[model samples]
Target: MRERTMNLLKLNIVVLIEKYKKVTDVARELQLKQPTVTFHMKSLEEELGVPLFHSRKGRIVLTEAGRALYPYAQKMLSLHNEALRTMEEYKGMGRGTLRVGAEPAVQSLMMPVIADFLKRHPGIRIEVQVEPEQKLKALLMVEEIDAAIIEERAALELPLAFERWNEDEVVLICAADHPWVLLEELDPGQAGQERFVRHAPGSQLDRIGQAWADQHAINLWSPLTAASPEGVCRAVRAGAGVAFFSRKALAGNEANEGGGIRMLKVPGLEDPRLQLGAAYRKEGSPASLINEFVHFLRTCAQI
Candidate 1:
């Protein structure tokens, strides 16, 4: 029986090349000469007895075999890093970094909870990136970040699992001086008459708001569409238009503060709720710190 030689370095080169889709790019990223990267790739293809990439006009695209092997290579690299961390921990070093992505609205409400989490796991360094929902999902799919907190769940199509951390009821908010503030409840017939501020189209909140209005036969006279929840809130506060927000978002503000804002229940919109959660790639090894963070978020919501 012939013993097959397994070259880990060659495997890493193949993975890097496929990930970057160009030898020169991979070389620059790895801080190695382009020739060196190319050499390893060629050697790996030979050792595997198959071509790993299809080269076309200097662009490299992964072959089927390459695509199949990429995840295993990633797992191997992850294990190697984990082994190094274990050794460091054995040598009295007990610190690591956690990269997290979050949608904009969650940044304000979720950060305090995350702070409590960091206090408990003081040795785990934390980094947070604020991104839109789609971009956050992209980062998670590419393994760029360990986890993310997102508002609208519909847009993401990644092979990731989510655990609901908190749920909040969506409410219509308007400046206290707005005409709608004087009404006991919103009337769908009058909806078309009022200037409205809302999240941009395709946002989870926007979709929900639109659906609710449609169901009630309300035609919104949208005067402002903002990309972020805070933007919507600010616009409403400035008397630009009425906007829908989660009750949790407006919890701290007094009704009359800054000339105030009124939180009105959308007439006929039942349980207009948003579920906020932590999401991560389903196949990867779960980080203990991330698991702990999820647990903390759950506990906070339960309280």
Candidate 2:
């Protein structure tokens, strides 16, 4: 009997045919006779109102309809396998919370990863804390957060174990028409002499900028300090000043840059070793949720 809904078996058949390109081969792998496999293909085609495959001499090939369906089919099957794996990996993720601490730079890059994990594990709620590394370390001591993603600049030799995941650069941005925008050789010593717009004071980003200025002995001047990265970039784009931004954040948040912002490479900045890492408490064994979320960070924090 034909099922009213789409069957994974039929989808698998289409996928298998793409690989084997023969009815007998697909039937053998799927543990069905050739005729039964053919019937499934016909039924699947009828339900979709489009042919999934076409025969070329004695070979089978996926048609345009099947080509379009391939990735979705593979994704569905993969998720099914993932569900089984998750079930085996842990007793249950039905109800739990994963508290995550991240700096704004890490948060900008990891938001999608967080979203995707939450979408897959709908039963779990994620509470994200965007704070500096030191504060996050304090939270770890008190067990306020299960995982903390920290920037290298703000990272400290905390009692907790920290694992580096991804590295990104902090770039300087200015209005496209700014005199420094097209310069190939910029002097860090004089960076502080220029007008600047910075992120909110006390933030890791602000701290980075402040520290960089100190290192170069530049008396960095800021006429405006914005509460959000977007605000800082917006001011820079309006020719108010330049600001330091994570390259990853700049890429994902084009709206903040507009067409008037240009990224500048200052001598003292733009190092790749400024990677981000995950930190957690080390005094006691971590809970399963902590371990799971850390694993997620390790895997998805990189491009």
Best by TM-score: 2
Q: Which stretches of candidate 2 lie over 4 Å from their true place?
A: 1-91, 270-272, 283-286, 301-303
lDDT of 1 by residue, 1-303 (tens): 534554667667767777777888888878889898878877777777888889888789888998888888888877888998886763442556768887765676777877887787677677998776667778888888888887535425656778777777778888878887777766767765678887866555677778887887778888788887767877888888887777776774333356467788877776677788888765543465566666677777732
User: TM-score for each prediction?
Assistant: 0.62, 0.64
How far out, in Å, is residue 185 in model 1? 2.3
Worst 10-residue stretch by lDDT in candidate 2? 281-290
Candidate 1 whole-model C-alpha lDDT, 0 to 1: 0.74
lDDT of 2 by residue, 1-303 (tens): 655678889888878998999999999998999999999999999988898999999999999989999888888888888888766555466557788888765677778878988886787888999875567877888888877888654556666777677777778888889888667778886567788887776666787788888877788888888877777777888888888877777787755644677776656864534578778765533376666666776777563
lDDT of 2 at 188: 86
Q: RMSD for each model, in Å, please?
A: 15.2, 15.9
Candidate 2 lands at a TM-score of 0.64
Tell how far residue 159 is off in model 1, in angstroms: 4.0
